[model samples]
Target: MKIKLKIWRQRDSRSKGEFKEYHLDDVSKDMSFLEMLDTLNIKLIKQGDLPVEFDHDCREGICGQCGVMINGIAHGPLKNTTTCQLHMRSFNDGDTIHVEPFKAAAFPIVRDLKVNRSAFDNIISSGGYVSVDTGQAPEANSIPVTFEEAESAFDAAACIGCGACVASCKNSSAALFTSAKISHLARLPQGDKETSTRVVNMVNQMEEEGFGYCTNTEACQVECPENISVLNIARMNYEYNKAKVLAKK
Candidate 1:
């Protein structure tokens, strides 16, 4: 396929960014989106040009690190698909593809098609895990959790912290990402002990990281590769409110 790319290029966070145009005539229909990028980079390198830098690890769509805005959509036009899993076949022969890094105040541009998402790590560090001492592995049936509860927690745990939620939100909200981390543990026995404190700390940390408030637009879930529910945001609100009430005592 012959594809025209209008890609954002920036040397660093402080540098000015703008779209640069390039044409690719050799993109294969079977090539993954990242593979197409590799072909482009190879052509650029042969001409001694700086190749576009984008993040990718375990390009099988499991790592969630290969996200990019494609044609104004997060991770391309397909529902619940990551960029690395996208194929050139999705586009027509003469399509103009606009590729850019995930944009948000919290996700500062590192270079062409690369953004720093460490704010997510800061939110997780605040209280996303079970800190209690369990000492050793317990029996499988010891917790007595119902199957429904386990499934719900597992669904929430499916979030991969890709920051697509933030990038897709009009307000640049991290609510979906933060809430998934909160809801997963809040539903589990091992994490219940610190639920109140965990919710409080993590929510606070999310705000500190400058993420905008969620207004129920639900754009986050629409672009989320994991299809993590916005209901997790409701669960997080419940936990946060419960935590605030408990702290008054």
Candidate 2:
């Protein structure tokens, strides 16, 4: 099937970017979205044109590095799907797809479809972990967790930190991602000691990184490949407010 793509092109974060159109006459319906891009790159290279640059690792859709806005939607129109997992068949022949990097003040475009997502790393580093002394691994049964708690924590932990939430949000908020990280550890007993500090630091770091506030649009979970719940955001808020109040006391 033929496809028309208008992809964003930029040299670096400091440079201006614009959509460059290309036509593919031999796109296979079976080809994954990244595979379709590979075909386009192959064609461009053969024509002495520089290939479009996009980031992808673990095309199995676990990496979350392959996100791109398609037709104004983060990770395309599919719900709970990543760009790498989206197949060409989802698009019809002669469809004009607009592809661009995730847009946010915190996610500056590195080049083309690649954006510097280090802000996510910064948020994680700020307080996404439980600090403990180095020693032999603790026994698994030492701290027994109920099935419900374990399941809920796992659900929040499923977030791959794709920045799709930030991209899909009207305010370019990182609340969903931030909350997922916070909620994941908060639900576990091992993370209890640092929960208050973790929430405060991570939430502060999110604002420091320039991510906008979440307005409860719930767009983040819709585009999140993992379908991480917005309830995590509520948990984060509760934890954050409780921390601030306790700190004052």
Report clashes for each candidate as comma-separated counts: 0, 0
lDDT by residue (tens digit), candidate 2, 1-249: 999999999999999999999999999999999999999999999999999999899999898788999999999989999999999989999999999999999999998999999999999999999898989999989999999999999999999988999999999999999999999999999987799999999999999999999899998998999999999999999999999988955
Candidate 1 lDDT, tens digit per residue, 1-249? 899999999999999999999999988999999999999999999999999999999998889798999988999999788999999999999999999999998899999999999999999999999886577877788779999999999999999888888989999999999999889998888888888998899889999999999999999999999999999999999998888877866
Candidate models: Cα lDDT each: 0.92, 0.95
User: What is model 2's C-alpha RMSD?
Assistant: 0.8
- Clashes by residue pair, model 1: none
What would you estimate as the lDDT of candidate 2? 0.95
TM-score of 1: 0.97
* Clash list (residue pairs), candidate 2: none
* Candidates' RMSD to native: 1.1, 0.8
